[model samples]
Target: MRPRKLDQPRSWPFIVGAWFLRPALVMTTKRDWIDGLNIPATGGCVLVMNHLSHVDPLTAAVFTHDHGRLPRYLAKSGLFRNRFLGIFLRAAGQIPVERASASAAGAYAAAVEAVNAGECIVIYPEGTITRDPGLWPMTGKSGAARIALETGCPVVPIGQWGAQELLAPYAKRPDLFPRKTVSIKVGDPVDLSDLADEPQDAEVLAVATGRIMDAITTIVEELRGETAPPERFDLKKARARNGRPLEDER
Candidate 1:
């Protein structure tokens, strides 16, 4: 079924996003957004989704938009280096993250602030497209857990599939003829209450991150109708095995 057109909110970013994304969505993929109402109508929240393909962001943005929330992604600082793209991203209120730098702390602070101010912050815990050969979720980073712990907001986990079929990871060409089915399943807010009041330590953060990734992996497993591997794939190890450097850390 075609997605129903909801009244666009009067925000410039929302307007611009819808203007370009809506038609592209209709033309490219058949969206299956399940449990969209799981997203709160009004409140500060964090959304953690597994990264599949480069196009996943656009598909995810469309899903979030259809659910009545404008997703503010923690995009890489590189995307903002382009003159025109930088202006547009800044105007859209997206946060720029400098990986492996002292300035990354500032990005974390900004994300916490955005959540406290009642905005939806979208984060890919894996920090890039999955290195899992089968495209299952891999080991997640601690950023999402840190933000959730700091802001005390709901961390909604989303599992998605099919974007890879349209544009496989690191592929130059896209298959645009037959529209693919982008299946998105939203899981309940991960329960971080147990660790909310606990001191933020490596152990606590790892536990919280595991919970978030498990939730995402479960949903993805359901969508694919297959069990995930016993252990989550490690990108670093994969790169080491291939004797290559990590290329896409977005």
Candidate 2:
């Protein structure tokens, strides 16, 4: 089945503002960054990024549009609580997720359907903005891994810098005067096809998730010219004896 559309609230301005104006700003200030990068023009891919600020999503979406595709994001349900924003989000084909609800199944199902429909799904693996002091990407969750492993979709990892300064996560509002330049570096797509889809062993999932974050970290480090923590995720430790170590360790 195709994804649902908004039948209630009519918020065209928000869609235009979000999908058009914001992306245009990113292009101009960043010196047409998307035009300089190599992004695939077709296919059902997952754009994963480190969540430093709300602008992360907009930046990714703009890149997708520049490469000739529309992006569908899985957003927290809280954003939709406000009657106005809810209308706009729904109309734009954004997925609503209840981050703290007992029934997050609906959100996941929506994401699966969107991907199956050949839509580019944008997801923040961190699930929220990074709280690290340096604005680095925190330990990400396993949902993105699960999706990629299951669908065999190409997961495009993007490292975003400068978005935090453009619109700080906890700030009351963004600095609109000087027009901050946000940099988004898109990494090569990752294929999880080689990994098994069995979620029974938490160790397997942990290892896979770490690999996903590692790709994001590499891109971030290259873009910002700063090294991330030595250990982003301890999948081996998390797995204990169930973890798979290299043969060289033997």
Candidate 3:
């Protein structure tokens, strides 16, 4: 669908990516995009979604692009390691995040600026693929909340599923025999007005993050038609377990 209006010039890199990726995705997968209109047609906003597979971003990009807004992601720094790919990503206006390092904070500043500049900033609050046994959204990081609270932009929660079917988390191979349905549902903007001006401390951030995760998880449940575990997965505990129990992180 063509955007009703273009708030920003479609950058060359974005155009190139769309030209190459959109058609490939169309052929390789079936799309089930719901409520994409929730994504602001032309405004600065924070778009948060669950992370399930490396392919998640690509499918999400297609979803967002078709909805009339280009997604500028908080992509991991490792994707920028390759010289050619790094140049393309930089030209595409993607932000790099050195997760778990002090430098990771830089992405927050960049994301806030992007949101303020009338661009949609897509973030996977999980920071990485979920370690949850059921592949439900796990605990979230504060980056999305920090950006939303800082800019006071609309925090849009998008629930994603089915990408992992195309390429399971951390799996080296993709299963492409039967076209997978990439289901994406956009939920209402998470309301933070009550705590908008409150002190931006750990407690406040945690609350905001919880609301964001809850919104996303609720949508994911709707998409999957399954209930998420009562307690969200704690990745820190998984790390302490030396990442054992494999897929059954329960």
Candidate 4:
């Protein structure tokens, strides 16, 4: 399979930050961890992460830098509409995907292409910021798994915390003062070699995605030492909406 071509360099700032700035910041409330990890400089791979706040992407970028690799990510189409930020996102090798469309197959394809091209593609499996009242990870979408199965790329489960403290969800701006510590944990690469020969099945893909997410959830609970909500993160809101009885009979 031909690898996807990433027409831009996204890891430049992260590389700069890690080499020059991360050291200074490491001293104050700073933390990061990786276990049984190996991030290949060239190859197709997916970095699946739990989302909390906007800072999630930047933190992941920093993780790639520290591990000596370039990272590409899928961003919502809305962010690319911005004049300046959009340019930066594009130059940094971010792929803009339209979620409202009937299908986001194009974006997923692009990610696969990047992997085939020997680049690391990052995806937030949750598909959006956690609405978890407690701000932990929510149930994830199956797109990440689909990409992994299609491209034969290893899915790397990532767990993150403290981005919410840097900038709480729904906050207008990030909190910069006390320099809150952020931790990123990378687990062993999830080998998808078994699925390479099998044709894609929705059920099989979902199970694969769920297994990867479960790994991430365990890490987050370990880091925070609290059990996450048992409900699948993605279905909670839809279930709530359906449960509400019809109202307002005039």
Candidate 5:
């Protein structure tokens, strides 16, 4: 099938961001994008993906853009602190998420509004890069499920691998030699039908969140060609085991 053209004009910030990122991606990563047509050519939807490296966003954005949609990410609020970056992010139409705060409600509202208006929003349910020792997906937050339930839009799961090699989790430097192969596979919309009618209570949200994460993990397993742990890693447990303060963690 032919890819659809972007329905809206590209913003200057998105154009500029793509300009810088495209070359770096071409230089350092060989992309293997599969089943990209699974992403709806036009509509409001949530793209749920596992967070591996800082570079994954660039790769994912390119994949979505190539498929005719501009990805709007629910990014951490800290990135907007710099005046220039703040301006660019706003201009690029990225949503800022105030992690672990009451203000996060605003982000949720904005996401719902965007979805209802037929925009694609990307969410990393794990909230941050996986703290898993083996780089597997960890326990997810409930935002993605909640948003899907609220808007009744498609939630597309994507499994991505190889970005870690380009830039390891929390590593200061990126290795640009020998060009890494970045594999990304798109999965069908998650089956949230059973819980669609349920009230958006904690129990309902938890069940929906589990389904979303399970779908994403299954796709990741396919990309990695390995089995994930029977149980996902819990960040709270990891912190307690290491006796690290919550604020000190990333």
Candidate 6:
């Protein structure tokens, strides 16, 4: 499929990134981008997707860029540790998030600001790669919902597969030859209008997050042509089932 013409202005960081990364992606993987125009052409929005592989973000970025937007990801703070890489990331408009800490709130605030500024915020609601044995999306966190409610921006759900073929989750090496296909299906904006004016309570956020995940899972079901487990994978529950203690207690 032809890429949507890039009419939006891009900064030097984006230009440089595309110059370096896009070519490699193009050469190594075939894209099966479905309904990419579902991503807003202009305005602040949150694009939430199920996390599949470590390298999925590159595919996600290319998918977003192909449809005419630079994806500003809420990346882990650890990624910004390198002095030069940090500078490049900051220049590229990526937000550094301290995962699993009070400081993560800072990233939430930064995301809200980016959304308000009309930037496209790419968030993996699962936060990390899936642990489901079948690679179905695990239960998600509520960060994406909070940002959407705070900014009243559209929340678009994406279902992706095949990145694992290129680089399986937590795998050190990638299989680049033979060219894996990265397929992503973009769903319509999740219907959170009823909850738009509701108070930002835990229950409200969960309901919104569930809707977002459900929408994404539906699309993933479409892509995989199978049924996902009735209950999404829960890390703590899995650990308990295996007689393993939670991380903090260990």
Backbone clashes counted, model 4: 8
In model 3, state the lDDT of residue 32.
89
Compose the digit string of candidate 4's lDDT tens values, residues 1-250. Answer: 1122324354554445556655544543365555524555567788888988776677667567556566788888888889987876787778988885754688877888888888888888877787677777777777888888887778888888887887787688877768787887877777667666777787777678778888888888887878988875554466578784222111
* Model 5 lDDT-worst window of ten: 241-250
- Model 3: residue 92 alpha-carbon error in angstroms: 0.6
- TM-scores for the candidates: 0.93, 0.80, 0.93, 0.82, 0.95, 0.94
Kindly list the per-residue Cα lDDT of model 5 for residues 142-203, writing each as its tens digit: 99999999999999999999999999988879988899999999999999988888999999
lDDT of each: 0.89, 0.68, 0.88, 0.73, 0.90, 0.90
Deviation in Å, model 3, residue 88 alpha carbon: 1.0
- Residue 169 of candidate 2: its Cα lDDT? 84
RMSD of each: 2.2, 8.7, 3.1, 6.3, 1.7, 2.3
**Model 3 lDDT per residue over 1-250, tens place:** 5434445678888889778988888877998888988888777999999999988899998788888787899988888999999998898899999865688778778888888888899999987888798999999989889888889899999998999999999898988758899999999999998888899999999999999999999999999999999999988777768955332321
lDDT of 3: 0.88
How well is each residue in 1-250 modelled by candidate 6, as lDDT tens digits? 4468777788788898788988998889988889999999999999999998889998898889889898999988887999998998898889998866789899999899989999999999987788899999888889999999999999999999999999988898999999999899999999999999999999999999999999999999999999999999987678789997533210
Cα displacement (angstroms), candidate 6, residue 176, comes to 0.7
lDDT per residue for candidate 1 within 1-250, as digits (tens), equals 3343444354676688778878987998887888987887778899999998888988998888778788899999999999998988888889999988898999999999999998899999999988788999999989999999998999999999999999999787989879999999999999999999999999999999999999999999999999999999988778888998764554
Residue pairs in candidate 4 whose N, alpha carbon or C atoms collide under 3 angstroms: 3-116, 3-117, 4-113, 4-114, 10-92, 43-118, 139-233, 139-234
> What is the Cα-based TM-score of model 1?
0.93
lDDT accuracy of residue 89 in candidate 5: 91
Over 4 Å off in model 5, which ranges? Answer: 1-3, 247-249
What's the best-to-worst order under lDDT? 5, 6, 1, 3, 4, 2
lDDT of 2: 0.68
Tens-digit lDDT string for candidate 2 (75-140): 888788899988878888898877656656788777877777667788888767765667777677
Worst 10 residues of 6 by lDDT: 241-250
- In terms of lDDT, the poorest run of 10 residues in model 1 is 1-10
